[model samples]
Target: MGLTFSANLGFLWQELPLPDAIRAAHRAGFAAVECHWPYDVPAQQVAAALSGTGLRMLGLNTRRGGPGENGLSALPARGAEARAAVDEAIAYADAIDAGAIHVMAGFATGQEAEAAFIDTLRYACAATTRTILIEPLNSYDAPGYFLTTTAQAEGIIAKVAAPNLRLMFDCYHVQLMEGDVTHKLERLLPIIGHIQFASVPDRGAPDHGELNYPHIFAVAERLGWPLPLGAEYKPGGPTEPTLGWLLR
Candidate 1:
């Protein structure tokens, strides 16, 4: 079977509005789409675009805590804000019929942060039936982010003990922080809710990167990954021209 891809509207088609981006993804032959933050756009407009284009809204993230905060759920002192962000994300995802909600863990550390994260995740899981995801960002890209490794995320998932909680395994971050991407995929397949990709080092389209995407995609197919892999890369210019990688 051929590999399918999801256009991360958060990066692609930056020139167009969110609704237009959904339409653009469909025209480009993407099977589905995901985004980082769609709260600014009206959910009705986004839903209308998804309905009109016949594409699925894969996932979205919660709000940041405040200035310089990448996320809120991991901050020990910001439990209320964290839960509020979770509530907002759940409501937005419901309006758009999104498949998952990635709860971002801001820059924090220690057992307190982990405890806060677990509590917030429990609240999020109890709040919605949709799958909840936690991604491990590379230190180089997101220094001090609470979640930084799959092992740590695995432990947290175990503590949360929610069936809907899963990992957002972004290949670029995982490869940069730790090698053996395919092996991790094989091992973590049970906990993986969504898979995302970008060129290593540069975070660009998959055509030019240290990691061989075709090989990785082939492995994903062999492993029986259920959904379209997410293409979360920077176009560096007009998104349309940068899409040669998708066609190739």
Candidate 2:
């Protein structure tokens, strides 16, 4: 079978109904669709949309609070609060039957923060049946974020030693932060549970970017990684027009 792909609805529009965006993704030829936070829409509504379009919910961000709000994985100092947050996210995941949750490691203020993130991740791994993916955001996009390196995320996953916990490998962020994407992907394939991409310079369609997506996809295929490749890019225009490269 061909690799399954998911379109991120967050990048699709700043203001649009989730169901409509998902239907549009189906029309654009995506097998699945993801969103940042689906809390805006009821879980039942999201489920209905998925059923209506016959599209799967790839994943959703567990970080709900504002920018300054240290996510569950980053606020280990406030252990109770972090656990509560993880519980809330797990409940939502159960409701929507999501396959994964992108776990953000909030601001990295100090060593204490790192410890907190580790603790939070361990808790989340134990609590959720769905995979918990640790994303390494580029410092340029998210300054002070704790888990910014694939290596660091790998180490954390190793320490936890939980099969359910894995890395959310974003090609654009890794290209910006690490550069050697193919090598990194090869090295981290075992630990990586999810993959997302955007064009390098402008965060637009993959074909227009500096990265070689065909080669990347080929490598992924060669590696025999049985995971969905997330098309989490900002479409330069309508989703269909932007996806011509992939369809070809």
Candidate 3:
């Protein structure tokens, strides 16, 4: 099968609302779309937009605790809040028929944070039919991010060991934190819930980066991974014009 791609609405199409962004993604030839947090807009509205556009709503992240907060999944003191966030994300994802949900780890550390991460992931895995994703953010962008490397993520996944709990291996972040992406992608393909790409260092687009996206794509293809590579990057300007890579 051919490679597929998801438009990350969190950064792309900033000018449009959630509903319009879905439509824009469809027009741009994306197989699916994802958002950071769409709770502000009613789930029904986003669902309608997806139905109208014939585009899949891939997945979305739970709410970040607000300004200065990255996420809540690793906060040991906020277990109730984290579980509640899971329920809310489940409702929205189910409403829109999204197949997955990304559980953000935030900027947390230590034994407490690890315990919290395990507990939150366990709860989310038990609560929803949709796949739960755990991503490792780069320190430069998310300093003190709870999960920072594939090995760390693997260890967490091993501890959680939930069928539904899978790692979200983002190329941009992984490349920044650890180089050897192609091998890592091959090694982690079985448990990767989602795959995302952007230009390394700057996060401009998939092309013109320190890492070669085409080679990575080739590696994923050889590995027989069957999912859309999410275009999770800052357009640097307008999202529409930066999509020349798609045509190429």
lDDT of 2 by residue, 1-248 (tens): 85767889988753568888888878878888888878768888888889998888888887545656646567655677767767877788788788888776777666787788888888888887799988988888778777788888888888888889989999999999989999999988888888999999789988876899989988888889786688888876666668876686
lDDT of 3 by residue, 140-194 (tens): 9999989899999999999988898898999999999999998899888888989
How many clashing pairs in candidate 3? 0
Better of 2 and 3 by TM-score: 3
- Local error of candidate 1 at 168, Å? 0.3
Name the regions of candidate 1 deviating beyond 4 angstroms: none
lDDT of 1 by residue, 21-81 (tens): 9999999999999998898899999999999999999999998767888999999999999
* Model 3, runs deviating above 4 Å: none
Deviation of model 2 at 96, angstroms = 1.3
TM-score of 1: 0.98
TM-score of each: 0.98, 0.93, 0.98
Candidate 3 CA-lDDT value: 0.90
In angstroms, the error of model 2 at 228 is 2.3
Clashes of each: 0, 1, 0
Predicted candidate 2, C-alpha RMSD: 1.7
